[model samples]
Target: MNRLRILLADDHPVVLAGIRALVEAEPDMEVIATAADGTAAFDLADRLRPDVAVLDMSMPGPNGAEVAERIARYCAQCRVVMLTVHEDRAYVRRLLEVGVAGYVLKRSAPAELVRAIRAVAAGGLHLDPAVAALAICRDPPRPAAPEAAAEPTEREAEVLRLTAAGHGNKAIAQALGIAVKTVEAHKANGMGKLGFRSRVELVRYAASRGWLGSLQP
Candidate 1:
């Protein structure tokens, strides 16, 4: 059986160590690298292209979303799951907007983290139930579309494609000959329509839909 290759990213060494123990305990999964911040996470991910990346939402130089975005761009098959203490829907929304596939709270059991990793690796979305319930009750703003979650507008689609490709807003605008604000608007719309709660979800959805293939170098 092929072992699951994983990368761990967290600002806290203790937490990172704990996660490593939990993940590596599984015979089918192994930790190939560990990072203390977002930049390191991206570097390791780019170099190793692990099957799954477990990341802390708050980290130095790029944050979890940025790391996930970069991974999605360079390692299309890699799955990113945010391990965070944050329960805010806005934060979750941003992660989903970028196409991350999993969100596990830090307080959750190690088993939950394992579950999230397995789910994401299988191309499914996973969210801590507590966080998801809170989001459902508040009725947050929507992006992209409603019924059928129809394709975004041409510009919005372009932005989504670029976003999935790991391009920053400024970069996307420059490449697409649009204003930065316009790029933001389209990106927002794309996320809203998809009802993504975070950048992670957005990236996953775009990838699953094959939107990023066109943007690959």
Candidate 2:
């Protein structure tokens, strides 16, 4: 079996050690490298090309969002998972925009971090429940204008909600008892109706409507 390669980055020594231990304890994951600052993290990620890079939101030199952006540009194959104490929607939006695949709160259980790494490694997005709630509270609904496209049908909405919750097409199909092609169609139609061109935009839209509130950890 191939174990998941992981790179960890954080400014706090104790937190770094704790995260390393937590990740190492998982049988299917291994920490290939660690950095105490954002610059080192980016360098390690670019060099090692780990399956996932777990980053702290605030670090010396460049910060997590900047590092994530750099990695997204320079190391497209390596996914990023942000471990942060912030539940701010602005931080979440910025990180997501920069291609950070997962956002797990530092205060969340250790298992949450492990789950986040696994999720992003498998090409899925993961957001902490608390941070997701911020979107619901902050983004008010906008009244649709007459020129806007019609709203998505029930099936499309259901598929989109599941997509926002980080389930890929196959997984969504399995869960909803539909064909994978059907799942894709619903997702495409839903995103088109909402004028969203990317998964990040779909996630933010879902969060705004409290559709992602059901996501746990």
Candidate 3:
């Protein structure tokens, strides 16, 4: 069987060791490298191209957001999972904008991190349940002009919500008991009505409206 290659980065030695042990204990996952700073993390990721890069939000050199952005640009094939202490919505929004696939809190159970790694490795997004609530309490989105665009219909809203929650078209279709083409149509109409051009924008909008509170890993 092909093992999932992982790269871990955290400045704390004991914490790093603990995380390494947790990941190494998984029979299907392997830690190929570890780093104490963001720069080294990016360097290792770019060089080794691990299946997933688990990073701490706060680190010396470039920081998690910067490293995530760089890796997204230069190492598109590698997925990023942020293992962080930060529960702030601002941090979550910024990381999502830069293409981080998973956001797991350091305070969460050890199994949460493993689940995050597995989710992102399988092309899914994982947000810790603790932080997911913050998405609902965030400040509302900035107002758009009255004539700018119409609001999304109820069906469109449903599609956008699930999309923002990181479900793909087929999954959304299955969950909603709709056809894939209809799911795509609803997604397109919702994004068009809201003037959203990207999934990041849709997610940010969802966060502002507290529509992401129901998300699960």
Q: Give the per-residue lDDT digits (tens) of candidate 2, residues 1-217.
A: 8999999999999999999999999999999999999999999998998989999999999999999888877776677889998887888877776777789998999888887888777766777777865643355444444455689999999998766654556657777899989998998888778877666667767766767543442
lDDT comparing candidate 1 with the true structure: 0.76
lDDT string, candidate 1, 1-217, tens digits: 9989999999998999999999999998999999998898998998898889999989989999998878766666678889998998788777766767678999988898998888777655667776754433354334444553575788888787666544557656767898979988898887776766555555545645755432111
| Candidate 3 Cα errors over 4 Å, as ranges | 136-193, 197-200, 204-214
**lDDT score of residue 130 within candidate 1:** 62
Stretches of candidate 1 exceeding 4 Å from the true structure: 135-217
Error of 2 at 77 (Å): 1.6
Superposed Cα deviation of residue 109, candidate 2 (Å):
1.1
lDDT of 1 at 205: 59
Global lDDT of each model?
A: 0.76, 0.80, 0.82
Q: In angstroms, how far off is 61's CA in candidate 3?
A: 0.3
List of clashing residue pairs for candidate 3: 136-210
Record all residue pairs in model 2 with backbone atoms less than 3 Å apart, i.e. clashing.
none
Q: Write the per-residue lDDT of candidate 3 for residues 1-217, one digit (tens) a residue.
A: 8999999999999999999999999999999999999999999998999999999989999999999888877786688899888888878878876778789999999999998888777756678888865543354444544554788999999888766655556656777899989998998888877767766667767766767443441
